[model samples]
Target: IQHALSGLGYAAVKGVRQGKFFVLNLDGWGREEAQKQLERISKEVLTNPVIEEYRFEIVD
Candidate 1:
């Protein structure tokens, strides 16, 4: 990832990560509850719990 970015003339970039963007339609859940569930799902289902890291944003 870093190599590709560097080759594209982004010399200062030390790291590059390709992340997943998913639109999960939570029709009834509020923002707080949705965030909680997304966190849970992120840990338990979305990634490798032992090695990988992840982040989420609540988009309207």
Candidate 2:
């Protein structure tokens, strides 16, 4: 993507990566529990740490 964009006059694009996004509605959970579950899910289920990275944000 970056290479193509740079060829197309986008000199400012240093790099480009594609990733997935998800929104999980945890019903009635507190911050601590949510954090724990999210961490476990991210490391164990959502991503392959060998090649992929993951991050999440919680919103009210």
Candidate 3:
């Protein structure tokens, strides 16, 4: 997951004791677009159905 995010230009500054954080600089893209892109990336790259599952929420 960390590797996938890093490849997409997000910096995984913290990933051990506190789970993970991918710091992304989405230049000027709107929140909705960014969220959609991240969702695709997570589904296609970050997750392996044989081993992992995830759920998320957007708080705004």
Each candidate's root-mean-square deviation in Å? 2.6, 1.2, 12.3
Ranking by lDDT: 2, 1, 3
Model 3: residues with Cα > 4 Å off, grouped in runs: 1-21, 55-60
Question: What is the C-alpha lDDT profile of model 3 across 1-60, one tens digit per residue?
Answer: 666667778785445232443444566657798789878776787776576665545444
Measured by lDDT, the strongest candidate is: 2
Indicate which candidate wins on TM-score.
Answer: 2
Q: Is candidate 1 or candidate 3 better by TM-score?
A: 1
| Model 3: lDDT of residue 2 | 65
| Tens digit per residue, CA lDDT, model 1, 31-60 | 999999999998998888788888888888
lDDT of 2 by residue, 1-60 (tens): 898999999999998989898789898789988988999998998889899989889787
lDDT for 26 in candidate 3 is 60
Q: lDDT score of model 2?
A: 0.89
- Location of the lowest summed lDDT over 10 successive residues in candidate 1: 16-25
